[model samples]
Each structure stands twice: as structure tokens, then as C-alpha cells.
Target: MARAQREIGAALLEVTRHADVPSEALRDDGLIEAIPELAALGETPQDPHWHPEGDVLVHSLWAADLAASHALEHDLDADRRQLLVTASLFHDVGKPQTTRRMNGRISSHGHAERGGEVFRAMGRRLALPRPLVDAVAAIVETHMAHLSVRGDPSPRAVRRLQHRLAAAGTSLDDWGIVVRCDGEARGPAARPDASQPWRRVAARLQ
Candidate 1:
């Protein structure tokens, strides 16, 4: 097997074997294992406009921390909240396998696609329910949409996402929360204020 697939396969086996935690806890651990790939893609120093470090892992974890914390404050149901936290944590797990060099810096240009594949494989290895695994994979694939939205999001993009949301149902909100958290954890200057967006979305759903 390829090294990346091997690593993910091993990790999934380990998680499944030692999944002694509550279902929720196991979800958290699974997410942690999945996100290092985001760093591999150079989504680290999340504030791409101004970042000092080349460590994608550090950047990814910081975003995860910020994202999870933000998700905890809302008036979400238990499962949905867990979904948010889990998605935020695993949003970039495919990074380590997709590392590359660009413009005198490191980046993982195709990390999202790579990570999605890794996530799908890992989900199968772990025997995750198809619905749950699919949700996680979709979140990984679409995590970068927010960056585009920050610029000039095309109607096509929004419609595409809306279609995805319609199909995924409640879980789609989890991806949205992850996206918001990603923006906030990027950097001091670039972090968008998540409170309002969180409230708007949360209220609309309720």
C-alpha cells in the first residue's frame, strides 16, 4: 500500500481497536487522527496573507482548537454540536500526505482531495456507518469554500453548496461551523468575527 494509505489504515485500525471511549469521545479521537493532512497542504499559518511558521500541523491544530471552542458555545443539539466539533477537528486531516513546495514555501495544493480519499478509506477500515463517513468526507472536500466566499463567491458556488447542504441535511451545518472556525483561527487580523454568523445560522435553524 502507499505510505499515506498505510498510515491512515493503521490509524483507523488503532482507533477501532481502542475505541473504549463513549461514541462521542471516539469521534473526537478519530477527528484528531484525520486532520494533520491539512498542514501538509500548507493551510497552516492559516492567515495565508501573513504567517511566520512553515509548520502545517501547528496551524491545523490551532484552527481546530479555535473551531471546537467556538462550536461549544452555541445552543445546538448534542449530536449536531458533536458533529461541528468533530468536523472542525478533522477538516484538514489529509494535509500530511499532500505536502509540496511552492513559491519558496511549502504547500499542499491538492491536500483536500487527497485528504478526502484518505478519510474515505479510513472510514471503511474503521467500519464507520456509510452516512457518517460520507458526511466527514464531504466536509473535508468543501472546507476551502469559505476562503473563496471571503473574496467574491460566485452564485454557482453558493448554489453548489446549497445543493450539498440540502442533500446532507443537518450535518451540512457542521461543515458550515467548521468553515467559520477555520476563518477565525487563521490569524489575529484575518480571523472573521464568528459570533454573528454563528448566531444567525443557529437561530435560523431553530
Candidate 2:
């Protein structure tokens, strides 16, 4: 079990540090061998209407790559890059558990909230650092913030989200990064306005 944990840690490290496109870091078999649940993420289905690209795994890898590019293009420091890449990798880790056919449509309602709980649990089980665990979990939980405020968003709503992120040891900027990548990772028909989350963050939630 300890060896397995190290392998898991090592695989994650490879993706976080070495892979420009994260999935490229692992040899084909290395990922599923080191981390099976992450592999299971590959089997979980998403609605084509929103994810014509494929499963949660495909979206995740794409998002992570986008995040890596963003970090590089914007000159984000190593710590911030790690946080963004790791958060993107784990953003939808809860989908396999929460997904279901609902009213004839594929839905993983409440997945972001559930993803946060499951990520925290997985991080503890892996003996990961408390700060890393919390920050990633917070990002997973709120990655959907822009959608929740779609159409017209209230200042109070924005401030509440801002405070929640701050309390979690991350901030709106980090959350916005995840949000933008997530939106961009989807099929064209399903992608939200990538600028929306940034607009709210730029407002300073005042």
C-alpha cells in the first residue's frame, strides 16, 4: 500500500511538473496502474450535449493542458502553476460516483460540491499535505461558480463566493483560472462564455 501511494504520488508529480500536456507524462499503463480511480474517471460518461469531446478524463486532461499554457503565458509562479494544474486534474473526480441517468438525460447534479468532499477524502487517504488538499478541494467545489451566477449575478453572490474561497486558503483568481479552463475544455456547443468568470473576479466582488 505504501508503495502504491508513492507510485500515485510520483505519477501525479510527473504530470504536475514534467508534462506540458499532463496526460503525456505517464506511460500509457502508468496512470491506471498507479491510480485506478483516476483511470475510472475515464469510464464515466458525460452528456455529449455538453461534452462531445468524450468522458471526464478527456475534459480533465484538456483542462489541465489549458491551465499549463495559461500559467506559462501569464508567468504564474511554480506554486500557482502546481495549484492550477492539480486542481484541473482533480476537478471532476466525483463524477463517477454522482453520475446518473436523470429524466432521460445524463446528469451529475451537485457534482462540484460532491467532488470537493471526495477530493478531501482522497487527499487525506493519500497523506497529502493539508494545504494542498484543501486548496484543490476548494477549487473543485467552486469550479462551477460562473454557471451558478449565469444570466445576471448579484454582488452579494459574488462576495459570498469570494469569501468562501479566501477562507479556503485560495482566492478568486485561482478559481477563475479553473473556471476558464473548464469552460474551454468542453465541446463548442457546451462551452460557457470563458470571459464570464474573469469578469466577476475583476469586479473585486465589491
Candidate 3:
């Protein structure tokens, strides 16, 4: 494993294991400075209607924490677990750039694809393995595909997403995990209603 990968994996695992709290390792290692997108999240505001929790940074870590718990429940292997954790961390990297107030609501339109592009560059800069980087970026880019399914519910759409996942060396299972975690991070007020249907479709494809 790349050193950058191991360091991030360990830091995220610690955060995920400890109820999403910022671990000492992360602070001491200067991960925030190393990953500026994370620092930017602190300044980005989220609409309370959706994110009753707080800023994008808070939501990202919270989601990663949830993902870690789910990974344990499912007994995911280290690689899959790491991928989920990493994707969760990078999931909203574009929010700082894409977030905007529209109709009295904060929206991050196209943030997923924007985030994916940011991660691809960041991953390369950090010297992360090419396949791992691409896979994580793929998951981030397509994370919102499930929401479309909630509205459309088309098998063709599902198949198209599946092909994309395969091309990136990931699977529907991995994509679904990130989506569910991201949706649930809003806390109970904004429950993952849409995610449930998406999960059903993803489950069939998996």
C-alpha cells in the first residue's frame, strides 16, 4: 500500500471507529493542511433543512463514521473498507467551489462530478495507486446516480451505472455504501428516504 493511502486509511478508520470524532492522529499528522479541501469544508455552509448537523466537513466525517460502522457490520475486507472510508472523506470535496444559495436553499449542484475531478488530482498528487485513485474517484463522481434512480427507477439506468462501476474497478455494492452513508449523514430530520429505493436497485445489480 502507498504510504499516503495507509496514513489516510488509518486516520479515517480511527475517526470512523470513534463515533466520527477527530482523532489525535489526524490532528498531529496535519491531514487538514495536507488535504485543503477538508479545511475548506469548515468554511462552507449547508442548509439546515438538509444538514441539521453543520458544515460540509462535519457531514463528511459523520458519514465516514457511519460507513465504518456499516463496514464492520458487513465484515468488509480491508480494501473495500478503506475505499469506503476514503470515498466518504473525498465525497464532498467540490462543495466549497460548487455550493451556492438558490431559492433560499444552499445547493451543491454538480458537486459530485466536481468532487471526483478534485479527488483524481489530489490522489495523483499524493501518489496514491492509480487503480485505487480511479476507483475512489469513480465512486465519488457517480455517488448521486442512486438519487436519479429514486425518481426514474429504470433498469437501463442501473445497467449504465454498473458498467461505469466495472470500468473503474468498483462495484454497485461499493457505490451504494457511499450513497447511503452520505444520505444518512444529514441526521434523522433528513432521513435517507431516497437512498432506500436506490439501495434496492443497487442490490439487484450487485
**Top model by lDDT, which number?**
2
Error of 3 at 156 (Å): 0.3
TM-score, candidate 1, is 0.63
Ranked by lDDT from best down, the candidates are 2, 3, 1
* Top candidate when judged by TM-score against the true structure: 2
- Residue 92 deviation, candidate 2, in Å? 0.9
The CA-based lDDT of model 3 is what?
Answer: 0.76
In Å, residue 188's CA in model 2 sits off its true spot by 2.9
Clashing pairs in 3: none
Clashes of each: 10, 0, 0
State every prediction's TM-score relative to the real structure. 0.63, 0.89, 0.83
Q: Report RMSD (Å) for each prediction in the order shown.
A: 6.6, 2.3, 4.0
lDDT tens digits by residue: candidate 3, 1-206: 33565576455445533433342345666676556777898899999988988999888877776777787888877677777877887789888999999889999999999999998887766667688888989999988776563364676777787789899999777887788788888875556545456556666766
Q: Which segments of candidate 2 are over 4 A away from where they belong?
A: 27-29, 190-198, 201-206
lDDT (tens digit, per residue) of candidate 1 on 49-150: 533333455554555555545544555554455455445556666766666557666666776767678877766765555666677677777777565544
Cα displacement (angstroms), candidate 2, residue 40, comes to 1.6
Q: Clashes in candidate 2: how many?
A: 0
Provide the lowest-lDDT 10-residue window in model 3: 16-25
The list of candidate 1 runs beyond 4 A from truth reads 1-54, 148-152, 169-172, 187-189, 193-206
